[model samples]
Target: MVRKPLPDYYAALEIREEADEVTIKKAYRRLVLQWHPDRNPADRETAEEKIRLLNIAYETVTNPIKRETYDLQRAASSRKSKAKPRSAPRVEVPKEFMMTPLGYPECFVRSLGRRVVVHSRSDDPESNFQSFFASTKLALWWLPEVNNMCRIRKLGSKARGDKRGAAAGRAGGLNMAFDPQKAKTAGAEGSEVRMAPANKGQKADSVNFVTKASPTCEGALRFESASQRGQYLAFFPPSHLRVVPFLEEAEDRVLDFLFVDFASMFKFITLEEVLQPIFSAEEAGVWIELAKLQDDEAVKSHFKEVMGKDVWDVEDFQAYFEGHWATFEYNAEEKKARMRPKQERLAKQLRATPKAEEVVAAVAKTDESELQRLPVGALARALTALAKASSTDGEAGEATSAQIQLLAALRAVGKGEEEKCDIPAFELLHSAEKVLDLGGDNPDDTVLVQRSAAARILANKALKSASAIEGGMVEAGFTLPDVVRFLLLPGAAGRDLLLATSCVKLFEGRSIPEQREVLRTAKSRGSTNTAAAAGTALLKSLGGGGPGDHVAAPDAHVEMVAEVAECGVRLPAATALLRRMAATANPLKLAEALLALASRVGPGQAEDMTHIAESLASKGAFGNFPIKTILETVLASSKDDTLAALVVPAVPGHVYFALLVL
Candidate 1:
């Protein structure tokens, strides 16, 4: 007996296998709306079939038990199919359709009546049918045809050669009559235009026009009737669109027109599949705003915006897709390089001015690119100058001010790539102020303090003798107690735990006695923060609970927990530190944090991690994160089936997601 093949509920619903309940419902609802019979009356039969399959898929997937059973069956079926002998299918391969550069080109052929709507080609505005007509803003499809030609089908039409004349043509199709001889004459003399009468027994009256660029207007197209001599389709008076005589000077004349692309495809694809960039949905949809395409200047601007080129064509679009649209990415490094001169100017001003705060304020006001370009060496000198100046007065306020500037400059510099700084660790630590003075009055100062502390940790790691940097820090008056305080601070904000954990990690570089001091401080404290507790746990886990016991570096799990906590998702149990990741963090940062946490998960922790991930996800812990980013994060991180159960919706209707998953 043969086992029945399991149906693909996920495919029918148009979602990923790991899609959570929320994603399933959303996909179901969207597909229902799109394929509802009432909404798609023109294709009611197809809509009905779609709605039926969608209901089955939705019902199966939305139920936990049914979905589980189905998933199992699907997995078994997949394995069985793979194990079976490979056999070529009997069905013939479909012909491949090359997506036109003009993007679906599915638009209505609206006629511009003789009232001079846009411009006056003739000296007299009234005579120039080429220039003006009011747009009805009505939409229609410009279906593709063979030999660089297309059929201009009206909204309700199916047949092309309707012989029932104008009324039938309006109801079904239009027949274009073109006289080749007369067309040549009209082209040469720019005088008269005429077409031969329709031949007998032509059932469909549909007119086909050769697609060509308009000679009169840039980016606009002029459609001269294929079967008629010099006759072109134009909007008649009273808003009726029909073919008439083309005259260089007359009441009725040929004119250029615009095309508006619509989502017209010969085959069906899920909304999610369409949205994925890897699918190159460009072929599936037509070009953007037809009005822009019709204007010479607008075309240039459009290409520049999308492809980073002042001008582009069909070939360029093809190449762009083939290269995965890399040109579209904004290169901040290049942009920052462009602002190098501005950064140098600011650094010069910083060196010249004794009021470092004013320069720091100027740095704050400067564009991120300019700040990124600011020379690290120059910044170090300015910081060293501030520290030296503050030391002379022995004023706490002046010292605090220098530290404040240090924090601001470090934060700004931190925004760019770390490798760009290029300064040696010793020089940076020696030249830049080592102490993080606690003297600010603002409530926001705590956050700045935490971030600056974290930044300091990162900076110290750059030292040549990173392990013994504690000695240098002590000499600079930032003692072991100060490091302990940073590590034991409440993990209330995104960077608080990060600062704390980073501080604990620094003990690795300290002497054994110094490490003992950190452990003793934690034990001595009445209330211990998460980081201190983690250190205690680490000491106990490694069988060293005694005072003389040596503390080891933080375990991978501890560091992972700290990192996730730093992303504002507190762990052991995933709870958010902030109201939303979107409020403070961007998508890239959030994705990185989640993936980093995931990558550290051992096999034994997969189930717990999945639950934590799911709970965090259900609570919107990730914020208004992009689906593509999350999908990429998930795909790159893990292959654990249990973890895969943590559903995150990707770019809806993107084929790229499907392609990548497959």
Candidate 2:
């Protein structure tokens, strides 16, 4: 039985649940300074409890799994204790929005949930805002936007609940001041917020827009529908161009004529850096007039004379603008500027992986798709932690949507790049049946689940996934269909029979040719040489020393023996497999392996065969074997003279088989 719950650590820590990790750490360190046993002599008992609770909370929330579980339980208990109605979903904050010459736009949710996009100038009298809203009973719920933080409030008026105010956070510490004594109108989902007239003392003192803020900075823009969509009238932020005195629409047309709408990617950079001495306030007025002229001849001459540059094409102007502005993707589905992964990238990445810190940082940036470069365990941990950090323990929230979207992104990056997970699990499989806790359940049923869970957390080559090791299906991302054809396979040695039989059944619906390709990759290449030897021993152990032991599924063993002969055979582990295979002494295996290697060699292809022969000779791979059995087997397969010459390539005037099969 589970133990009773411990005391809540957050209460002891004396911080909000949403406190940042660094903030939490800072708080913890502060407590240690104030209440550590060495420091607290007057009230040691209380300090002891406080310290104990603080440590427990820090450990619990910092860990992803524990946090997730704790969040779930805590949320449930909180909901049960408090009687509160669920809040309605709201539109996401903008990633980056370029303020039109008129001003920054405010998005509002209409009664029926439609969006009304509109902008207002601080200096534009109340009449302009009233005319814009015109007969719509809507309220402007102003929020102070900080550097990329999107914390939406529920059931609380900012003026009363939040003491700090910037009306709307502005450059140079200037902002609108909110009057809490004024009217408040808010509602639940499907409810409308009635509009009220702009009251006095609510507007900015004056409008001066020559600002140092980046014109466009990013925020959490949602690609999906927005509740805060609205219509916009000609408006502009009061900037250096405020003195230009041109009609808003006339100038916005020329500036944003070639604009693209790259969502969520644009970032703001200050214009002061680009326009310092190049374009003074007086010069900006002249440029505006040139844009409004509509006469090509007059506009061209004036523009060139003012900016000190001759106009080339749209590209040239776009380049110039880019130097002074932020970039965005177009609304039309045009070619993207971002780079995609190269096709040959996987060839090198098969063995390479990112460091742990890099993986975690990718998660923090919410660019979780790059996690494909990380190990499975690390990927799981980072993703889980990111999901946990953004969300509370209970019902799905905005953070949950973000988490699911991140998963979709990560899935895309993992496509076609996976299945190189070369994890070995032959020994583990042999023992899986014993270690699995079936809870009085069937071992066969539980084995697949146990193996999959292990594989998901397990890292390393030859140890990726159990299914990957057995069936070479490592490329199959995140999908596991474990079907057992037999508890023990027909012809395979040891537990490899389990995999072989199960593999055949795994893709039961596939064609025979397809199945064979799948089976070969899974069993032969996925498994280690140690597993190969165990498979070899199974036939003899079953008292079948001949081909009839397991019916010939295919005449070729796919040459597990040739595998031992080639490149990997020189390793110490490779030497051991060779010795064990010799001791097992299965002639059918020998014949098939010999033919497979022979198949590779021709008169000109003697180098590989010679190397194999030397490795076998060095290992004393063949001892007291009947030469006639091999000779007859080789001769039977070697019908052509050229083919026969492959076994013993002639050198100068002599033919010697490298002392291997002499």
Candidate 3:
């Protein structure tokens, strides 16, 4: 015959009975890698089959206890096969009869024990005995006995044969007709028989019978009624003895059932596996009590441990001991009692400040390293708050103190001096200005300090020359117009001043629609005020007038003459003023006044006069006509060389005189 192949699990991974877990694992790994689906996707079915077999073989051989059990079963099967005879067919006994064979003495004794008691009565004693014997035989057949060496006994007395029969008949079949001599002989031969009249209400005297007697049975019997003992009987043989094994099996089954129920109820996992990893002993105790409130001992014990000898009070537990720190304190009777209220009050005060949210968020997010390495957002917020507070008017003193504290903190964090906080400094100045403008209390003192601080910072940063700096100063309540004018003035000396001048010039040149764009561009380039100043200077240079004027007159006029004369440009000055008078029909007095002043000035003061005259001419002014006439006449009457040269040079005088005459 062809031998069947070993199972695929055994074949695939080459696992043997001797293989250890590591060996099994290595073999499984090798096989799995060779047949992995990703590596051999086209032949997936075959690969998957191989993988399944490998897993099964590895699992079986790697587990020591399972391997041992498998080995024992395999060995037993092999031994049984080897011991069987090949020539003869093996006779199989029913499992129930395997321990006892038919025709054995035990079998006959069992059959005898299987006899049931039977009763009969008749006027003839022989007929009554025969009937009883027939019923007993039928009972024995119905329930066969397993052992042959069994016995029976009959109790009570029997009468002599014919006379007993006659008495039994007379007594209405209640008496037995057994011969005492015969019963005595049977008893001597190891048989027992005795008879007497049945009791008044009973049908028969007594009966004893044996079937297959279990070791447990010392003549065990069950009776339907002691009063009707002759009515019926039932017997159990050695099978009754088997009840001990059956009962033992039942007890084991019951234990198994109980174990199964327990496994289902409690889950088949140890305390270590299911509970211990997740919770510490104390936590577990708390959890168990929480789960089962009816567990009074657990609840009480847990409360004591958590609340420190207090009776269980939910409010107290929650208030004082709910968290890991357990720093909170609670009194059961006084619900509001707490430890460290002052500290809590301080915390609340800190939180109630305007920048508290920002501080809290920053603090919450900061780790120890971050807090140490950088300025925490909280410090920034606190500084911002102090700056704001300092900027407010009535609160100046407190605010200044806060600012000092803020500066200390900044220095502690290595931010250097106060000028480092430019934005905050500017904001402080602006706030002071507002307070002062609104007539807030003692605003002057606050404004002065803030402006001084701002100026210092601006100087340090070289922002004074920046047009953007002007914008900031303007925001800080320095009037933009005044700031621009100040910047354009002659004495201004920084690059930021030049920049501011350039910005003002650009703004003036731009149309209304274009001005905002230009201003934005200047601001973006950090030159807003520079542009403004440049525009203002251009307007002034073009004789377009200052910011106070809408229309500007030509240079050949009274204001222009005054400007030119102030600059000592006497000719232009005299010409511009005389022309203005001629146009307006003014008298000669103003013209004469301008000429006289010009004539009195010596050559040594000529430069000064020129500067003053130029300035006056630029203002469109000239003097009165009488002085102009004198200047013309004098110029005309000059004699000879140098004097004539000097006289000829007074051309502004002649021009002024001619315009005045017009």
**lDDT of each model, Cα atoms only?**
0.40, 0.31, 0.32
Can you rank all candidates by TM-score, best first? 3, 2, 1
TM-scores of the candidates in the order shown: 0.20, 0.22, 0.23
- In candidate 3, which residue ranges exceed 4 Å CA deviation? 1-397, 405-451, 458-482, 485-506, 510-536, 540-662
Tens digits of lDDT, candidate 2, 1-662: 11123346677667788876556656666665576543664564466555545655655554443454455445432322122111223323232222222112211111111222223222222333333333122212332332222221111123323343223332212211212212121211111112111222333212111111111221212110011211111112221111112121232311110011213111111122223223333332223221222234533443354223343333332222322111211111321111113211221122122222233333344434344443333333333333224223452233333334334443443343354433223322322222222112322343334333332222222123544543443332211122122122222233343344334323423333333333343345444332333333322222224433122322233244344333232223322232234323354554445444454444543443444334333433233335554454346335534233324321222112422345
RMSD of 2: 24.6
Q: Which stretch of 10 consecutive residues in model 3 shows the poorest summed lDDT?
A: 253-262
Over 4 Å off in model 1, which ranges?
Answer: 1-372, 375-381, 390-413, 417-420, 424-513, 520-662
Which sequence of candidate numbers ranks them by lDDT, best first? 1, 3, 2
Model 3 quality (TM-score):
0.23
lDDT of 1: 0.40
Backbone clashes (count) for model 3: 96
Model 3, C-alpha of 139: deviation from truth (Å): 87
lDDT of 1 by residue, 1-662 (tens): 12123457788888998997557666766776677555774665476567656765765565443354355434533431112111121211112111111111111223232121222121122322212212212222233343334443322223335555333333333233333454445553232212222323332223455444443323335455545545555433222234555543333332435432322121112211222332232443223332233244534443344223344333332222222211122122222111113344466445332244444355445665665455665555455544444333345454555456545555566555444334444445544333332343331364356445533533433332232445443333344445555334332233333334434444444454454455445434322453453443333333333333122323332343334344322243322211122133333453444565565545655655555445445545333556655565456535656445445554345535564766
Going through the candidates in the order shown, the clash numbers are: 41, 37, 96
Give the higher-TM-score candidate: 1 or 2: 2
Which candidate gets the maximum lDDT versus the true structure?
1
User: Which ten residues in a row are the worst by lDDT in model 2?
Assistant: 253-262
